[model samples]
Target: MDSRTMIASLPCLALVIVTLGYLGLCVVSPFGRCRACHATGRTRSRLGRIRRDCRHCAGTGLRLRVGRHVINHLHDEYEAAKR
Candidate 1:
């Protein structure tokens, strides 16, 4: 393939790799609270309150990162929507 064609393909390949990596992390990571009761597993009451374990990590849980930029964007969207 020509250099132009090869260069054009790089971004697509990178995007595919990044998407796959994110999916793999979702499959493997355990860092969030229980969904049923929104509680971490350390406390007995919270654990008891959960009728069913989380599907993501089989009750191990996952902590989703909410970055400042994402929060700001969400806030902006919310404010705009309210208008």
Candidate 2:
């Protein structure tokens, strides 16, 4: 309504929008490229000679997004509580 009120609410509105966008992203694509090896599943030595499998993603080149991981943990907790 008033300018002051609208300005105060702007941060909340922006946060909600960003949260919803992240949730949608997590739902649509739960797995993201591994950060360690950049989805190549292998990393090279500092000299770029020897290559080794990525330990972070176990060489799968994919990792659970943080949001998706949190969602899954919450779901597991809810199921346990329900039981």
Top TM-score hit: 2
Query: Could you tell me how far off, in angstroms, the CA of residue 40 lies in candidate 1 after the best superposition?
Result: 9.4
lDDT of 1 by residue, 1-83 (tens): 99999999999999999977765555455244556435533333455673565554455554453333355577799999999
Candidate 2 RMSD computed on C-alpha atoms after optimal superposition onto the true structure: 1.5
> In the order shown, what is each candidate's alpha-carbon RMSD?
9.6, 1.5
lDDT at residue 9 of model 2 (Cα atoms): 100
Among all windows of ten consecutive residues in candidate 2, which has the lowest summed lDDT? 50-59
Residues 1-83, candidate 2: write the lDDT tens digits.
Answer: 99999999999999999999998999999999999999999998788999988889988999999999888999999999998
The reply for model 2, stretches above 4 Å from the true place, is: 45-48
- The numbered model that scores best in lDDT is 2
TM-scores, each model vs. reference: 0.39, 0.89
Error of 1 at 43 (Å): 18
- Indicate the worst ten consecutive residues by lDDT in candidate 1: 36-45
